[model samples]
Target: MAFSTITNLDAAAAQQHSHELLDRILSTASSTYVTGPVGQGNGERVLVLGGTGYIGRALVPELARRGYRPAVLSRSAEVKNEAEYADAEVIVGDATKAADVAAAVKAAPTAVVISLLSGRKPNDVEDCRQVDHEAVVHGIKAAVANDVQQFIHISDYGVYRPELIPQVYKIQVEGELIGQHHGYVPWTIIRPTAYFPYLSVAFGDVKNGLKYRIYDHGEWNVVNPIAREDLAEFIVNQVLNDDAIGRILPVGGPWNADNTVTLKQAGEFMFELNGKTPDWEVITMASWDKKIARLGRLSKLTKQLKPVVFYLEAAKY
Candidate 1:
């Protein structure tokens, strides 16, 4: 039996091509070994939402490497060019729209549906809610409708104690996702600590010849930030390990004292990586408070600053 790749198709063509791809994958009589919660099996079709995003880009290829044919749903046209998706089937569609999501879900008899969707913009809370919460809800419904055996969700550790308003939406979405996982279908929620790439935001100031900014006197705060590739491997492994089912795993970087690094240390490391010396300034609590007060509750700056504030607060505990 021979296999083929599908690309750059319209909605109708994409749906038809998806079915053909699934039929080809499922028709294979030979069983390939797979890891994680779904156990070793044949004819396992995995559907990935947000497969074009950071973790998804790594995960789709990882799934393909593990002998599972992963079909990634994306809303972008550039998915055709992404080298990471070369091994997997790419479906162009919106996860937020029921018709689009249903089409993807119905494309194959999916054994597992993994959602890596999140808001791309930091300041847009509404868009975050739409993608993180509403679109996730849509994906869940579609999975249930299609009899998907297991669902794996990529959530943030910030959902543990959601203090910031933006984080509350994520928490809410987590609840809704878990609540919807009833009957025979089980769910696994992975709440990973900060990604190493997220720390690159501090580099923005450096680009303007400004010193790296730290909150609260640059005191060392231990945070275990995982690499996106490592996290992708962990997520895929969950699909083979039944122990992960019906559990919310709070995963960090490798278990080591070195895995934990303060933001100041992280900044210094970033500087060293860029072949520069560390030059950082501290934003005292008093200064932060004054800035917050001046911006007022309704200010866009306030919303933008809240995550930084929350991170500082979290570092203390």
Candidate 2:
């Protein structure tokens, strides 16, 4: 079960599981049974790790528009200057590299560190661990070294214990950080559910035979979505809200899973928006497509994991 109790767990496994569950609980907002509201932000300098991905692209503009300054951490020039952080400072740095991470952190001594990087590739779990898990450890160290008052990490809603949903990656990032890093600065963590923007496209393609999807069946878990502006709003809040420190916050909306509909349904909505007939079909979660071959499932996994399945278990929204 998710977060059964610590007494029943051994150290290492417990550490990993606890870390995961904490992340889930926060992202899913099980405490309030709410997805999460974008934070009430404070205008301040922020170091955004993994600020080149989809969420980052959507989030950076909000950071700038809302009065908070965002600095991006990128190892690739392509990912760095891809119109994502046009308004913010772009720093060439790797989150996992201690020196690079420290240099970036030191550049803005008073800023908060927000981690958005983690294992995203199939063959890159370890790499993700190195950057997401270990590099975060380094960031905390840097935060303390730089005397920053806050460390805000962008975590996921998926990490938690198995069994109740062991198929999921079930483990909390918060636990991993505190247990492993012992951050010296006041810290804040943001855990949000899947994003609606990408899901609209991914699911539409999959159901159209453009791709195969992955799913075991049923909707045991739910999708928690926050708009890019909402995410940015949360970041702004994190920067300004001094009381939010040392807390893990999850943000979502009044409508979560209910708002999360089937691909076909979503497609119809899109078609209506396009002033056309919705011609998409609902692909079986386990359906297979030959064009992308197994890669179809891989692509679907990214979307499914984004809102549905992880480690093969359903999300407990």
Candidate 3:
């Protein structure tokens, strides 16, 4: 069964709630495909779009260890020499092009196709549409034409309540998949929370005695960022599984003090870990809004400031 965990309760209560919820889910969960561990791969091929990324490095090897034949569709042939991709066959291709995606699917008789594709720039609307929405649609169409058994999409938790340009495209892709916009295809959608790296972006700065920046109060939002390895396992678990078909799973890391924290708490932890007193530069939302407005005006004159606007809006979110 598919489910999402909410971490809106107090720290202690949230931890206990997560534990109880997980226990209940495990006790009741059932899968239609349970013939063998990792099911019988039988050398069945699985095509992965965006397989040169951070999560793909972990996911490709896991699929190999589990007996599935992983085929990575990458734009760079250099991935062929990477140790992580050694276990899988690398098909050089650009996912943004429909013909390239179709050729990758047709290269072998594939059973499953998974997409971990997203734009490099979140603020660029055109880039987001091309990579996040159109590219994924290309993969989906390819999978449909090839009669692929399953198509799994790695979406973001932000799409649950979309505000950003990237998230908007992600939501659109989800709608197309669920509504059979192209053709009938069994699909699974995963909405994972933030990754640990995103949360630790300022750790080095804090260690260097830079004042930690935060919005007013900094307790407006809380997140539990999952590790790449953990997220990879979660995604692989759904591959070729009948129960996972047409399901949307929202997952996160454990709800401990270190894993679950607000923006303010994240900053405090960094300072404490670096053996320094908390030095926070809190910006009032009103002041931040003014800056964002200025950036918005500047973005129209040049493309460089679009990312700045996105980052500001994302922080406020």
Candidate 4:
């Protein structure tokens, strides 16, 4: 069975949705394989696209621990964090391009492919489409060509509720991943809600003499949050387990998100963590624009990045 909770979808929709779930598992005939070589070397081999990012840094090592030979598709020749790079063989290439993906496939045959790349910025929207949307299709195509059996797509907060984004990208990623490609490769589409580790850092900065600001009233229910370590562990566990194939695991951590914790409690946590009290103010839609003005200055953020913090301010997360 696929890992998705979207079981209510009709037949046509179910299979399409299920394809994303299938990519999550390790479906080889044997659950356990010998460490060295079990006659023919059928152990799972994985291709981790975008192995240098935060999630990738955490994931590749876990994948390695599972006995999967995880090779990385690095856009650059050398990875900045060599410790993360140590767990996997690095294949230098641009995942957004077919040629580069083809090279990655050539380097790792019958590999399960996982992409950590996402479109994080406005300028990178085109690139995100190229990487997140198109590259996924092409990567699966390449995997199928190479007889690779599994594909995993990790969609970030930006794909869903990005702080300042226009909000059309969710449909873009979902539509692209769901269209065609059945019978191509077993797949998993993971849409994790807001991330907490990064938030810890962002909020930490705000508490540490770093001025904090919000978008509107930090109103909407704070989104689901999963720790970086937990997410890595889930992906690793799923990738090597066949039962997880054809599943879309929508994972979130417990109490990782809750507005129930009042501002006083949140403030205390942040202040304690950072050793400095934060500058804060509750806002409303009427004052949203004005807040952004003062906020941009207070955050000491750049023109392209003010939205990230402002968005966080609105979050009770």
**Number of clashes found in candidate 3:** 0
Candidates in order have lDDT scores of: 0.69, 0.58, 0.82, 0.58
Ranking of all predicted structures according to lDDT, beginning with the best and ending with the worst: 3, 1, 4, 2
- Candidate whose lDDT is highest: 3
How do the predictions measure up, each by TM-score? 0.76, 0.65, 0.82, 0.68
Better of 1 and 4 by TM-score: 1
Top-scoring candidate (TM-score)? 3
- RMSD in angstroms, all models? 16.1, 10.0, 6.6, 11.7
Give lDDT tens digits, candidate 4, residues 54-81.
Answer: 7888888877776777788877766835
User: Positional deviation of 240 in candidate 1, in angstroms?
Assistant: 4.9
Greater TM-score among 3 and 4 belongs to 3
Summing lDDT over every window of 10 consecutive residues in candidate 2, give the lowest-scoring window: 308-317
Model 3 / residue 316 / CA error / Å = 3.8
Q: Which stretches of candidate 3 lie above 4 Å from their native place?
A: 1-40, 207-211, 272-277, 297-307
Worst 10 residues of 4 by lDDT: 1-10
Question: Which is superior by lDDT, 1 or 2?
Answer: 1
For model 1, the stretches where C-alpha displacement exceeds 4 angstroms are 1-43, 181-184, 201-210, 297-317
Write the residue-wise lDDT of candidate 1 on 1-317 in tens digits.
Answer: 11111112243443355446445544655342323333343547899988888788788888888778899888876786778988777788998887898899898778888988887744455676688878877778888887888888888897776644435666676677667643345789899888855566667666556688776545324566787877887888888467988899887675344555656667777787777877877666555555544544435445666445433433322
